[model samples]
Target: MKIKDYAILISVIMIIVMMVIPLPPLLLDILIMINLSIALTIILVAMNTREALEFSIFPTLLLLTTLFRLGLNVSTTRSILTNQTGGEVIETFGSFVVGGSAIIGILVFLILVIIQFLVITKGSERVAEVAARFTLDSMPGKQMSIDADLGAGMISDMEAKKRREKVSQEADFYGAMDGASKFVKGDAIAGIIITIINIIGGLLIGILVHGMPFGEAAQLFTLLSIGDGLVSQIPALLISTAAGIVVTRAVSEGNLGTDITKQLFAYPKLLYIVAGTLSLIAVFTPINPMLVLPVAGLVAYGGFTMQRNLNKEEKLEKEASAKSPELDSIKSPESVIDLLHVDAIEFEFGYGLIPIADKNQGGDLLDRVIMIRRQCAIELGIVVPVIRIRDNIQLQPNEYVIKIKGNRVASGEIMLNHYLAMSPGIDDDSIEGIPTIEPAFGMPALWVNEDMKEEAEMSGYAIIDPPSVVSTHLTEVIKRHAHELIGRQEVRALIENIRETSPAVVEELIPNQLAIGDVQKVLMKLLKEKVSIRNLLAILETLADFSSQTKDPDLLTEYVRQALSRQITLQYAQPNQALQVITAGASLEKKFAESVHRTEQGTYLSIDPETSQLIFQSISEQASQMQRTGIQPILLASPGTRMYMRQFIERFSPELPVLSYNELEPEIEIQSVGIVNISSGAVNMS
Candidate 1:
């Protein structure tokens, strides 16, 4: 018998035995801790070791459990002492003293609970970080990939990066001094006010509930009754449960605040069951010998079920979905880039000094602009060129003082001609008599803005679309024509012309500095700008899998380039032949199975065909050794691998059935994969 079979069998028996045994109090406590820890670990494993597992609630729950036990002890002792002292004992304390003290204790506890809850809620993220750090500490030589999930896009990398940057900024000397001043002047006052409120509330509750005079008939508040007992506790019970649910939901959403309210509304039955069970235990368990187990079980089951439904699965899925966008950013298969084709390179920097010809301004820095244009080349499924631009300066209307910079090969007016010439089927004749030419091209002209016909005469530039149409409509018409009639080279030339003169950079930087949300927008724009060859291949693989399969390499390449040009999120990698080769091992196993099914005339164990060959191979050598010793042989196989072992042993005799691992003598054992710590020792039942 294989060792794995014995391990499984023994583990099952031990669990059954443990469940049935009446454990001592110390052992019961140990078991409780172990069981809860195991349950937590199982939930963490299912959630794939993500950040949510590090949330503060786990430790809070453990602390609550300890406090609940302490509360139980306090309740028991109070009950016993009060019973002994009797009604006369309170009378001896002059009524006022006992009432005031009871109120004080209750008020104190309430204040503590509220303060702790607030502190936890406020510092929950920090707590999660600490939890993650503690969890990793136990595993030596193992480091978690800190940004693995962010890199995968469950959370935005750009968002995390921005947060870190903000922290760094705040850590600077000036920022630190400003923060400390604010904290002392502002937060210190707020905290002091809260503390004062807590003390006043505690004192008021103490005086009203205890020290204040009351008749004998009104003395019922001191004892357990509907108003002062479980009924009063119900609100807190409901609130805490709702808080748990809300916190789980919000944490999953990467938000602050608990989603407890939602869970309370969702599972009315669970709250009822838990409340009823807890009430029953508090009221009756102390007096009953046999009710303990059932109550404990009910409470445990309620907690388990509540967490399972509301806290774990849905939360994990939300966290995982958050990562999809990062994955989407991979370059697609249709992007192509050819660096050898050289042309004008447009560099962008600063803004406003340059009036954008229209709203389609290329507002970005030179480095960023280059990267995005590169990405565009990869997306378009065509060869991209190394563009160089010069004499690129933005000017106000009617300004003829063009400060053309390095390598000023052409004037801004000349650049405008190259741009207009990129339309599919137009030429110099098409724009010959436009009115507002020179000023439209940011040049000195008296007739500019009077009409295209007037400007064309003044500056030699013309409006391809009629003046009655909106500028956007005209640009779209021009773009459509350029896309269809002009080839990539002409389009590249046109883009270069625009890059040399168009104010694209100013368009990008303004919005990002305005709000927190714009950070994501800016980041996405950056990612889409730069298309790399490696990224394009990754996108193609996904597309090929989900959409249509492609065989034409040229078409594939061109499509990738176009996609990159469009700035869509995608990733691609070249086809992997080696991976295909590795997958062939499955086919080899199939061949082996065929060979066994057709076997003939072999004396083997009377086993199923599936396991016959496995058993034959395993025991053949042992059988041969036994024959030389003039003795029979017995072979054991582990439970899960039994089929394989049975087939291996079949080469010997058909009469012998393979023994299972557990059925063998205690001293006999064999190592098995995916199992731990099996030994040739006596099996100990729970």
Candidate 2:
């Protein structure tokens, strides 16, 4: 083992040795000084530590110090009873510090024991008990919070592990302290008992064994015994005080000294009151003005200095506040760009529904927002901005709005203390309340009272609380606007992230074959169609493969989708189930391909309005049939027609998802649910 590792063990062994073996006065004196040094060092460390956990080893150190003191007491007792002297250490304390008065020396020792045992040690033990109990009781909750933070992406795995270890250590330290505090208490009792026994035993040994005169023997041993007790008790009191400091300290930015100065002198007016009180006592009381007047004058001077300093700080703060705006304007002129910047997504609630966002009222909308951004980044390749939330007093108490770029995309009102009740997406159940529509999907719902929540759930209706309703709506709004949130900055950040893993792909595609704006357009096109860009390297690699073929974003997006076909197929197709879809008949596909117009602007379908209307009407009929059969309404079209068909479908059934044939995986089951044939002028469902 290392020398430092054995140092504590060796010291502890020496303490045990001291209890059994007699020592010379010179050696005893050296050991006595060491005891005082350790005690002073511990107390100083306690004062300097910002919190108890910082000095987690203190409880074990307390036990060691107490044992060392008791052992010294035993050695001193032996020396005093066998010979007329305990040690140079005890004699020096008795003669020099206590002024050769045995009574005064004894009284000092007793006072130290009383303070250590009754006041400091007693309180320390009780606090340790409570702190240990509470710490253990709270361990599970603290662990869960750490897990929650780790899950929420607020902290990393290593950080969470460190925090959990620290919590376990805190619980261990406090529990050990609860028992270690007893060591100090027992030491105090032992000091008192040992002192009394030595006094009685010394008187008998001196007069009876040595045949010394009674007066001489009593005087000699009494001084030595009291001094010995004083030496041991002094160190005991120091450690007990240290124990108290460690147990009682709270976590703070600074140690005990800084906290005291800042908090005690926080109010200059309080000091002024003290100065006035001191002046009144000096003037009215029949005390010596010589003693009282100078003290009062000092107090008044201190108060005046504090008041002057406080005024200086206040004046400086005011001047800084007054000058900040002009200084900022001069350094950086006002620009419309700064004022025009807006939150990509914002959630605002009225005063009545403020509880849904307020943390103190058990709301978790803020945390939910963090989770939403994370989910979107995983599900759709987008770094959604931190959604800003605010209370809008002008809004109806129960109303909230979800806005994108300062435009309200959707809004709804909810009952403050009610739950949203709906049948499991079925229109059969007729449970009634205040009629409302689910904001996200526009499903029919009712606002039912809290007491009716259990009945609704029991009756097979889904029940959602007010906060969840708002959060669900917010989630959908961000998803729909995910494409808009990602711009050049977000795209650059994504590319930078990709560069870390796939630098060659990013280097090959940008600036050589295409610019960053073109790549951004491709990714935006994918996002607009609800494609996830989380696998950015794959997307970039696919873009790199095809950028030389075409600069058109719509075609590049199609190529990216062809590469991500497996993901797209699984997204709509259930596991091992037929991928039911409505197909654009050959005649319709032929017509769309024939009408496709190419220009420098972009490739677009140039079919006349009448032909476009006819195609959409057929697609709508097929979509209604798909919805009725509980099939996911997906349309299969040629890669050339898919982009234009998406635009066509959006004008009518905005939520209908469309994909090209290349976007489907080779192995997926293709069950044609219907056909869209404008020649037939009507759609048919299988």
Candidate 3:
């Protein structure tokens, strides 16, 4: 242990020894002085602390100090009764401090005991108990707040951990103080008892055994006992007051002295009023003017000085405000640089829709955004950046807009008091409501009031609340643009996350075989086609294998998709059911193969505009025919033509799923509901 650790151990041992061993008067005097000094130090330290936790060890220190005081009392009581004197300190306190009167000495001691026991000790104990209880009660709330901040990305894991630890430490500190305060109360009671015992025992020993008269014995022992009590109780009082200060200390930016001066003298006008009252009392009342007038003058002078200083400060503030340095900074070039940065995703709503995102007004949109980020991470294997939600005054009251990379991608309107009811494939004529389109799916929906909600539900219309409507629209917008959100930084984060468990695959695939941009491009391609990259290990492993052969992201993505065929198959194919799809005939595949022109930058399809028009017309007819049958149209093409086919088809039908033959599992039976051929210009069902 260090020297300070050993010193504390030795001090505790000496306190125990002071109780049992007989000490010389000189040693007792030194110990008493040491006790007084320590008590003074403790209260000073307590007053200087800005928060209770700053003095966390105070509870344990209080126990030790109380024990040391009691030990000093025991030694002094023994010395007073046996030797007819305690020490020079006690004798001086008895004779000079109390004016050599035993009655006055005893009365003073009792008053000190009353003050410590009835006032400081009792208040400190109660405050400690209440603080401990409240601290414990608030622990769960503090923990939950930390967790919420963590989920919202407002704080990192290390910051959250630190906050949680601080909360726990606060609870423990208060609880220890609660128990330690009982020590102060018990010490006060013990001081009173020990003083009484010393007086009774000293009187008996002096009169009966030392051949002294009753008056002399009473005078001698009573004075010594009172002195002993005074000597011990003074220090005890200081320590108890210190305990009160520590337990009642609240979190503040300043110490007790600073806060007291700053807050107590906060208003110089109040000082002037006090001074005026004092002057009136001195002038009109029977009070002595000579005694009160001078004090009143001092108070009035203080008020005037303070008021003058406050005016000077106010003038300086006004001058600073007129200068408006903040406006100057805003007009600076550096401030304009900040405006160049843009958020990855921004959700802006009109002022009337503030409650949709404000938790105080019963809005859960912020919570829903947290869930959206998590959902994206789990389903798309990419961490979605924090969605910035703010109110825009320029928009209509009910309109909200969703932005990706500073560009508005989607917008919708919400009625606060109405529920959106979408028709179940057929419009209900009986349902009377304002017609609207569901922002999430663009399906025909109605804004029905609370009165019509039940009828709409009974009519088999899907009922969604306004918040849900906004959240659903926001969620779809994020999913649709998930690819655009995953940049190189986000890809690096994913790589680091996977590196913890699959370091080999990550190290081999990233930078060594392909750059983060390359990996990001592959992931983006997968997300664009609505593929789940949750099984990132498989994706990374596929990239590692084929990246050496080709640096092309498109080719690498195809390889990854083929490796994730089982996932793709499970996503679209139903159990024990044949996967129905629109197939591209041999003629179209051959045409795409011939039209593919290769260059250094990669292959491109250079089909003539006539053939392109025919392809689009034929594909649209087949897709429309399949849609009429209530089936999602998926165009199945050979591996070589699938990427080009998807790239070509996305211009008109971005939502359509274009799957390659190798992207499907071999066990899945393919049933062609329609075929796209160049000559037919329409689907031929077979």
Report lDDT per candidate: 0.34, 0.84, 0.89
| TM-score for each predicted model, relative to the true structure | 0.23, 0.66, 0.77
Clashes of each: 111, 1, 0
- lDDT per residue for candidate 2 within 1-686, as digits (tens), equals 99997997898898999889898878888888999999999999999999899998888788778888888888888888886787788998878888888788888878888888889989989999999999999999999899667655567556988999999999999999999988988888988899889888988998899998988877788889888888888888888889999988988999899999878888867776786787788788987778877786786788788889999999999999999988878866465458778877778888998777789998788888777876787788676776788999989888898899999899999997788998776543446578899998888888888777787887888999887888888878887877788888878878887887788998999879888899889887787778888888999899889999988888888899999998898778899888888998887777777887878776777767777777787788888887877777888998878888887787777678889989998888898878876554443333
Residue ranges of candidate 1 with Cα displaced over 4 Å = 1-353, 357-450, 453-532, 535-686
Q: In model 1, how large is the Cα lDDT of residue 257?
A: 23
Ranking by TM-score: 3, 2, 1
Error of 1 at 490 (Å): 29
Question: Which candidate has the highest lDDT of all?
Answer: 3
lDDT-better candidate, 2 vs 3 = 3
Error of 3 at 671 (Å): 11
Index of the highest-TM-score prediction: 3
lDDT of 2 at 609: 76
Poorest stretch of ten by lDDT in candidate 2: 677-686
User: Candidate 2, overall lDDT?
Assistant: 0.84
